[model samples]
Target: MKYQIRHRTHYRYTQPLRSAVQTLCLTPRHTDTQHVHHWQLQSPTPLQPQTDAWGNHSHVLAVGAGARMLQCEATGMVETLGTPLQSDPLGPDPRLYLMPSALARADDALRRSALAAVRGVEGRQAQALALTALVAECVRYQPGRTNANTTAAEAWLGGVGVCQDQAHVLVAACRAVGLPARYVSGYFHARGGPELASHAWAQVCLDPAERRWLGLDVTHGCVVDERHVQIAVGPDYAACAPVRGVRSGGGGEQLTVSVEIIPQD
Candidate 1:
């Protein structure tokens, strides 16, 4: 499956900004499942491109003073292999994903729940599926109940969150049980609407020795397929956020994001 994606982020500030620097993880990743044809990133200022520790394509955008607004756009065309599971023979050390991160850390209760979910699960893939089902039951897909800063424990306790929270819970749960997992940020081609087009999921390392990973969408309780586009991946959302930034002076800001994923024949 092929897709043309466009993502735009806009910021409006009441007061002009003195100086601002932003880290962008908007570029889609090239993997065994996907191929990038052409990609472009546009910003008011120049974008410095580099690869992060996780091997993600990243950019640093800096804006000078006297700017009341900022806008950034990323457009690209990618082709996905439509494979439900991924096998990365050249992936980074699987142990890196074993460690817990800030947003995806599991608590005692979460660990116990994870253990219970996979108590008798036969294989790694089966255990991962059980964990995915557990997350779906534990966290209801309700937006506005949690934000980006919400942790896996908090979301599990609240019993409501969006895709990000669900991903965090799945990642935390897998890690709690000694299974390696990481958060994946990307675009989902949903027919319902664009509300969930900007999606997230968990990639559990089924076999570290073989570098095998299974992508699970906890929100939907299924394995990832052609509809999912691979973007930056890391321990959690903070590491793979599309845009993260800091500004010297920007009083009261409003942000708006638009994402479009169109299927191509």
Candidate 2:
């Protein structure tokens, strides 16, 4: 399947910002399951492209003084293989994902729930699926209840959050049981109502030696498929956020994001 994706983000601030520097992870990743044909980014300033420590394609955008508004757009074409399970022969060591990040640290209650979910599961894939179901059941998809900084422990305890929270809980749960799992940020093409085009999921490493992984969408309680396009993989959402920046001075800001994923074929 081929897709044309457009993502636009705009920011309005009450006060002009003196200066700002942003890190962007908006580019889709070239992996065994997907191939990037062409990708372009448009911003107020020039973008410096670089690969992050986790091998994700990223960019650095710098804005000078007296900026009251900021807009960034990304357009791309990609082809997906529609394979939910894949092996990353050239990715970072799978062991690196075993330790949960701060935003995905599992608490004692979470650990116990994870253990009970996979207690009788046999294969790694089955256990991962069980965990995915557990996350979906434990965390109802409720937007506005959690923000970007919400942690897995908090979301699980509250039992309400969006896809990001679900992914964090899944990653934390997988790591609690000695399985290596990484957070995935991407785009999802939904056929109908309410689901955001911008999505998040988890990829569990089944065989570290073989670099085999299974992509799980805890929000939908299923494996990732052709509708999903990979963007970045990291320990948590903070590491793979589409855009993160700091400015010298910007009082009260409002942000708007629009994402469109059209099927080309």
Candidate 3:
């Protein structure tokens, strides 16, 4: 499947001041499952592409003073291939993902949740599917109830959150069950109703020997497919956020993000 993607992020400040420096993880990586044909990032500030420790392509954007509003847009064409039922993990040691992060920490309740998920599951793949289902069942999808910093345990306790929280919860639960899982940020084309084009999911290592990674979407209760365009992978959302930064003087910031993904003929 091929897709054309456009994403625009805009920010407004109450008080304008000097410079701002931001890290951008908006560029998609070419992998076994996906290939980037043409991609470009547009912003008022100059963008210098750099690869992070995790092999994600990042852009450092530096904006000089005097602009009250900043806009960043990314447009691209990508071809996504279906993962064969078997494949090797492409990056660093899988154990790196087993470690808990600030937002993906597992608690006693999360441990219990993990225990319940794999109670009768016979194989690792079955256990992973069960765990993903358990997370979806435990946390109802509700937006505006939590913020970006909300942890997996906190969202589980509330029983409501967005895709980001769902991915976090799934990551934490998988780790609790001795599975190495990491967070994935990407773009998804929604058919109808209400759905954010920008999406988040989890990839769990099912077979370290074969280096198999299984992509799971607890938010929509489905396995990630060609419809999903991979952007970045990390311990949690914070690491793969599309844009993050600090400014010398930008008071009371308001941000808006709009994303669209269309299939190509």
Candidate 4:
């Protein structure tokens, strides 16, 4: 399956009188399961392409003084070619994912939750599925209840969050159970089905010897397949945020993002 993805972000500031710098992780990666056909980015400022510590393709955008309204757009075509379940995992230190970040911190509550979810699950894949389902039940998909900085324990207790929070909870729970899991930011192409501009999921290292990672979408309670286009992977959302920036002077900024993923013929 091939998908044409478009993501647009607009920033409106109440007062702007200086410069801005941003880092973007909007480019799809070349993995065993997916390939980037063509990609392009549009921003008011020039972008310097660079790869991050986790091997994600990133761009650094810098805008000069006197910039009020800023817009960043990314358009690309990605082909999901192979079986995601059988896909070869990219060689990275799995321990990095096992280590918890602030946003994915785990505690006694999460550990108990993990133990409960994996009870009687025989294999890693089965445990992953069970945990995904548990997370789906634990966290209702409710926006505005949490923000990007929401921790896994917070979301687990709150029982309501968006995909990011759900993914964080799943990641934390997997780590608690000694399964290496990471956060994945991507686009989901629904192929004339329900439309979502962008999405987040969790990936677990099920087989260390085989170097295979299982992708699970806790939000949708399904295994990630060709419909998923992965862009970045990290311990949590903070490391893989699509856009992060520092500005000298921009007050009371409002951000709006629009995303579209259309299947290509």
| Decoy 4 TM-score against native | 0.93
| Candidate-wise lDDT, in order | 0.90, 0.91, 0.87, 0.86
Q: Name the TM-score of candidate 3.
A: 0.93
Instruction: Give the alpha carbon lDDT tens digit for every residue of 1-265 in model 2.
Output: 8988899999898998989899989998678888999999999998999988777889999998899999999999999998998787656899999887999999999999999999978988889989998999889999999999999999999999999999999999999998999999998876554445689999999999999889999887679898889999899999989999788887989999998888886
Ranking by lDDT: 2, 1, 3, 4
Candidate 3, 121-146: lDDT as tens digits: 89878898998998999899999999
RMSD of 4: 1.8
Q: Which stretches of candidate 1 lie over 4 Å from their true place?
A: 89-91, 191-196
lDDT of 3 at 202: 91
Runs of candidate 3 with Cα error greater than 4 angstroms are 84-90, 192-195
**Weakest ten-residue segment in model 2 by summed lDDT:** 188-197
| lDDT: the better of candidates 1 and 3 | 1
Error of 1 at 55 (Å): 1.2
Q: 1-265 in candidate 1: lDDT tens per residue?
A: 8999999999999999999999999998778888999999999998999988877889999999999999999999999887767776545898888898999999999999999999978988889999999999989999889998999999999999999999999999999988999999998886555544589999999889888888999877778888889988889999989999899888999999998888887
lDDT of 4 by residue, 1-265 (tens): 8888899999998887498888999988777878899999999877899978877889999988878888999998999874555333454777677888999988898889899889888988888888888899889999999987889999999999999999999999998888888899998776678668678999898877776788899887788888888989888999989999799887889999999888887
Candidate 2: segments with Cα more than 4 A from true spot? 192-195
